[model samples]
Target: GLKSSHFITPTPIQALAIPPSLARRDVLGSASTGSGKTLAFLVPMLERLYLLKWGPLDGLGAVVISPTRELAVQTFNQLRDVGKYHNFSAGLVIGGKPLKEERDRLSRMNILIATPGRLLQHLDSTVGFESAGVKVLILDEADRLLDLGFLPALRAIVSHFSPGGPNAQNDRQTLLFSATQSQDLAALAKLSLHEPLYINCNKPGEEGVVPAGLEQYYAVVGLEKKLDVLWGFVKSHLKMKGVVFVTSGKQVRFIFETFRRLHPGLPVLHLHGKQKQATRLTIFQRFSSSKSALLICTDVAARGLDFPSVDWVVQLDCPEDVDTYIHRVGRTARYQSQGKALLFLCPSEEEGMLQRWKDKGLEVKKIKIKQSKVGSLHQQMQNFAFKEPEIKYLGQRAFISYMRSVHLQKDKTIFKLSELPAEEFAASMGLPGAPQIKLFETSKANKSRGGVKQPEVEVDVASEEDEDHENVAAQSKVSGPSLKSVRTKYDRMFERKNQSILTPHYNSLIRHSSSASESEEEVFTLTRRDHDLPEFGGSTSGKSRKPLISSEDLSKRKLKAGGSKKGLLKIRSGPDKVIFDESGHPTTFYEAGKEAEDIARDSKLREKYLDEEKERMRKAHEIDREVARDKKRERKRKRKEKEKEVSKGFFFLSYLPPPPQPPPSPLFIQKWAFQFKVFP
Candidate 1:
């Protein structure tokens, strides 16, 4: 199978990791992406099972865990291709499939390729799904598995198949592999590996951890110009297949939608977390199979998935760390193939992120963007946004998402919001002005990491298929933590201070919108205090903390002349508030009895007041009309008097015209005498 599929030689990671893995020794491997890491462990898993004379009756021999569904799918496909000569029943156990169906067949799967949440579900709930004889425990992208997010599920899953279990897979040989391996030995310790060997392909004083054939370059562009540089690069490399990574899904949609409308001479596709599993799979297949295409997506596509013949990797903003940087660039330059990566760093992000890359022993060359090559998209973006309101809305969302992502960054030195040219960035996105990010500035967006397709209210801009997917996304739920609370973007958008939109216009946009499951949204208040606040100084001992600026002290604080940026922007109506009650706080309809009566009384009084004002205005308008008529008559009379005076002067000049013929006497007499003589 390997020879038929053109897998000729073993990469460094495969050579090192395979040997230790086959020797029944635990192995923790770190290798650059696209270095045949998938095959490294699969070979050993197949060999071990073959050596043991394993069969279907053995009951779940091997379990491969990946951080993402795309990666899990990729691993399952690779396993099928290479392990075809051997008899092993492998099944992909990820979300988006019918849980009951998966459970029915899951008990029969000898080897399972799964994500953490779904696998844990089966381990805890599925009947007859035994892991007693599970021999090999492999975690692909182990760094992500060790992240704070996936840690809980990983711990729970590991607890199910530990060595002390009654039918444990004989000391459970474990293999952990990632492009960037986790450094925390304590976390790895929880996985119960017996004296794991760390196999890293990186050599001291060698060309960095990234693929040697990959050429890396970066440019110090201001926040506003990053998009321009990216657009220029894309336009220049229209024939080259590439992936452009942005910070968030909103940004991915904005770039893809707007750029596709602009017609960049290539097929453009977008992949983000909010998309449905089917839509994501379809897009993944499309991009993978295309002869030449460009993919604009968030970090969702950064890990283990492979793309053939990829030529370029463009990163719009600095990634959170070196690991992400490696994964993003690793998409290209596979197995000695040459590729290029371009990084766009803002003026504020350049120093910190550059030094970070350098500390990781990476030598990224600095390059200047040729002003001649950079195509100006400001006017084009502005025109589209100004005319097409859909484009305008998307631009606003993209800007907001970028700001919030930067604000939420753990490192302030690399992502300082104050130093960024936000207004310029807004303009570059084609917005007339920047939206007020007061909500993000003071309070974190507190976006829910789980549940609800989160298609994130990233309105499907153009495609009907994408629109359908987005509608399903609003109701679809995932298990980052649980299905109990899904943080959808519905509430965050309502709270955003979009100064560009009029009250009625904006209301109409969201008036008909619906959500199947309403996620918990951020709330603002003057009295309630949170421990995460900086003023509290990180004390969590149940000690009573003081509110720095309360309603009473608000008048005392010398606030700036304009509106204050300190207070909460959106607040849920409290019990004490008179204007509203908690029976579904006011939308287009008022549910509270008191509020309804109050509105009715106010309406009557307002109608009477309007009638009186109308009467007064009518009387005043009549007087003004009469004054204007008198002014017009007086001007007509003045014009008549001036014309009469001019006519009288003209008549006098005509009456005196006969006295003006005395100048030609001599010439006239001589001419008359000559005429008489000549006639005789």
Candidate 2:
């Protein structure tokens, strides 16, 4: 056996929560990553199973549900060590695995740990509680499950177990565990538990940002400087497993490519929702096992994942919201281990997020550094000058002709700093505190005075024309597009028609009634034979050729014809009637079948409830065999006394009184009998 000293000490969260959980009380443990929450629940669960003598032969009893497959596997492996002493059979049920294998294993397992979706799939199959006999249920990441919209499935699974009571058969214990208890999660808990005990460890100043183990760092730089600085930071952390969080999938690909090119030997891989589950799992396994220098990913891999050895987390871009920011920083500072976080801020999006972080009382280490000049290969390609060797890159006149063909207009709005060299341009123009240079603003009403006194209106108009031409040339230089694509002054007069009919007014204007007109009655003429015609000419056997053109028929036919055209021709037609229900969705003919099924099921449920009520009332008055056979002792005693009295009288009569005549008076006999009875 490994010594007790081999195990790491408990964190504050573990210290506070493990005891209550071991006593079979509910717990809501809220702490950031690397806070020892995994072991907090694991230790208590293992200890209870150990002391209670729960093993595989007892049938499947304990179930742990996690949000992701990877987290479930990690938790399974963590507890497997302690479970070894008692031969506890723990099975894993997650997606991307065969259902038959999970079902077969669940038939004779002790603890079945699974993700919600896969577990629900098994429940949808033929497997029942009689086989598994599940007793103890644990939701490892309960908040995540609710957030992922698994409440309906969770409720159905919980309903399978009998309600806990003294006479209840197959009563099971439920344990809900989560790092964060959102409102939706709390609502879900109410459905699963029976007045459960609530435990919270997320106290302010103690459970939040002020941790002693992890160090937080921040740097302010331009948007272009982030990747270069992040690459530098990753190169510094040589042996640690670090993760870089970018914003988008495109950014993920870009950063991954850049890192590979910059450092070939670095074991860096990117994981996102766009990748297949198999590919994601493979990358995660490789990254977790190896001493990968960095793992580049997005917010998709942020929550419900465990990486115990992650030493650092670098936020590539400031997240848009506080929750996203929290999830990004949460990757590190996990468990009882130490971690470091580095946040890179761009000039375009720094101030707002920085203030928000500061308001949250985080001692964010802000470092103001000069922006890095190393550009991405993409950016370099965008900025490089191309010189052709053919015909000595073309003579100057030939180049001018080519430029004219391309309509390469010159930027006439000369910047004050444009005269400076490339080296000075970045420092002089790029600095935030640079003084304001001359900026030209066209004055619609200004007139330049003559050299001495007269107002030069013609000169003013000439300067204004020059400015307009300069503005057009500057725009043309920035975007190298064909001149034909540019809008002419004459094109501005007409309003831009909303080419698509997908607007509220599209159906309203079908009759073209916007123009003023007197009331007029609409008329239609219909033929009986045309009424039998099929739509879209699907099938028509011996249909009459005499077409009747009623106004209604004309309108319907035109609408059908319009609907056949694809894309932009589609109309945003409103329903004849609007129906609003509890759920905020438009109820149209499309959902009629589903609504009918729902109504039928509700009626069936009501009938079931009524039957159950009748059954309960009947059972309350039921009498058993033991109660009906019980006799009264007093009745038996009285009967025995009467028989004894009669026997005594008979004995007395047989003794000697038969030969005696009526010799005594009635009063004397009565008195004598009374005396005799009293004496006896």
Candidate 3:
């Protein structure tokens, strides 16, 4: 079957790693992605299982740990195809599925492929999972798994297989596969492997690098012009299959909707962690089979997905790090195929990073843009007819959420809604509420303007008792003949009083309206007049007046005034609180029956409260259970639907009647007799 399927020779990695792995020796393999690494590990694992006569009763012989659920599913499918002739049974355990169902499926499988977090959940919750015979443990994309902050979970899981642990049964063979070898991988090997054999199929000089067939180029663009450049590139390659790598899920949806509207006839797909498992699976299958499609996604599609015939990989923005760049570019040019990668860089910030990459031996060249092509592409995109109604309304929520999340990042190069095009886009999406857009100006511009001054509004602080007096003073000032006349009148009034002659400080204040209209006017107002105070304690006879209270008493009063309302005690009202009753004795009861009724009522109320709380808790539990059950049912339905489709496609071939055999001619019979030396 391998020969018939055109598998004539093994790749370098496969040729080197398969033999040691088949011998049940722990192996740490470091090679770039698409170096035939999957087959290098999978073929040997199957052979070892076959040699052991692995069956359902022998328990699981191998377990593959992947970083992402998509990768795990891909690996599981490949393992099933390779092990079709054997008796090994494989099961997938990942998040977004019912734990109970996964637990049930765990009993009968000989190999399990799972993500670190989900597998740990099962090991901690499911009974008899640790006892399942797992002989060979493989960690795929080990660097990515650790980078995702799964080290603690991975440690907890590996502890179960320790020699002195409760679940330890046999010395397990370990295999670690990664594209790059970092300090983390070195530590991981010491913890997981026992003097493992090291296989570096990437060659001595070109180890830890991208494939040679992949062409790399970058374009330095203005921060605001990235979308324009990306649109041009995507439109230029509209008929070829490609994956556009973005930084976040928000960007994924944004780019997807943008291109989906610009090219409605094109097959555009999106993949991210937020999507449901089944939906992602269906999208993966569709894109794999699509001849010309566009997949806008984040780093989730960076590793382990084998997309066939991908012509190009476009980075919408500069990647966060070198490892990210390599993995993203690795998505294309798989299996020694020719592919191209384009990186969009902002000249002000990313030029340094680009130079660093070049210094590191990456053969990346700058792409010169044609002004006429970009202009024509932009015009074409604007003129394109958008027919999707959902795209018009979908990005508003995502945009708002992304803005809120990055509000504190202090990165000025990030896109802002203050730009005219962005504001229009937001308005078209039907975004609710007034969008708050703040534009950051460059330092050179600020220097040129000699530092722009912001308008200041001063607030006056006054006591509550003086609030009415301040308002009356403000009204009188406004009602005066004129500002100069009012000042003169206030001066005359203060001079006539001659009792310490209090004068108010005047200042001009401007208030701007919050209306969206462009023609709104700013309102200016003068400061309020000050109020006169009375002499202290009305001049006592032949003695100086003293304060009404001491400093200590004043502080105590303030403290009492500022006390919490909840801390105050309230008098209880009930028969139990009645110290004296209507009788001659000190303690006598006039109506004992009323008192008994009150006690009974209180008891009944307490019981009712408890019952209500219990009912609420029960309802909440029921709701959670119902949600889990619904998810399980939805997954089962999708699986059965997929199975039915597959079966129907081949069902006709399976059930078709044999073709009728035609009778042999006389001349053919004579020739047959002559050849066989016999007559029919």
Query: Which pairs of residues clash in candidate 2, taking residues 3 or more apart in a chain or in different chains?
Result: 33-334, 34-334, 34-335, 35-334, 35-335, 36-335
> What residue pairs are clashing in model 1?
132-167
* Model 1 TM: 0.64
Give the count of colliding residue pairs in each prediction.
1, 6, 0
Error of 2 at 172 (Å): 3.1
Which residue pairs in model 3 clash with each other?
none
Model 2 agreement with the true structure over 1-680: per-residue lDDT tens digits: 11332556667777887887776665556665556677777776667767778755677677788877678877887777645666677788877766676666676677778887787777778454343366567787676676556777787777655554223465455667665555776687777665566665655642234335678887875543554566556655567788888655555765565456456356888887678668988888888787656888877667757765788888875654444555566776665567788887655345666666665656678765443433333332122212223212222222222222222112222111222232222222122222222222322222121112322111111222455445554655554333345445333222234424446665443454634222222234433343432333233345533333443556765646645644113333343555666787767654765776775679887687789989987776464433444445566787788778766765674464543566767776566556546224
lDDT on C-alpha atoms for all candidate structures: 0.77, 0.58, 0.69
Ranked by TM-score, top first: 1, 3, 2
lDDT of 1 by residue, 339-394 (tens): 99999988888889877877788989999999987878998998889899998998
Cα lDDT of model 3 by residue, 111-179, tens digit: 889998888998888887754356788899998887777777888888766442123467678889988
Candidate 1 least-lDDT 10 residues: 516-525
Instruction: Candidate 1: list runs displaced more than 4 Å.
Output: 164-169, 205-208, 438-680
- Give candidate 3's whole-model lDDT: 0.69
Model 1 global lDDT (CA atoms, 0 to 1): 0.77
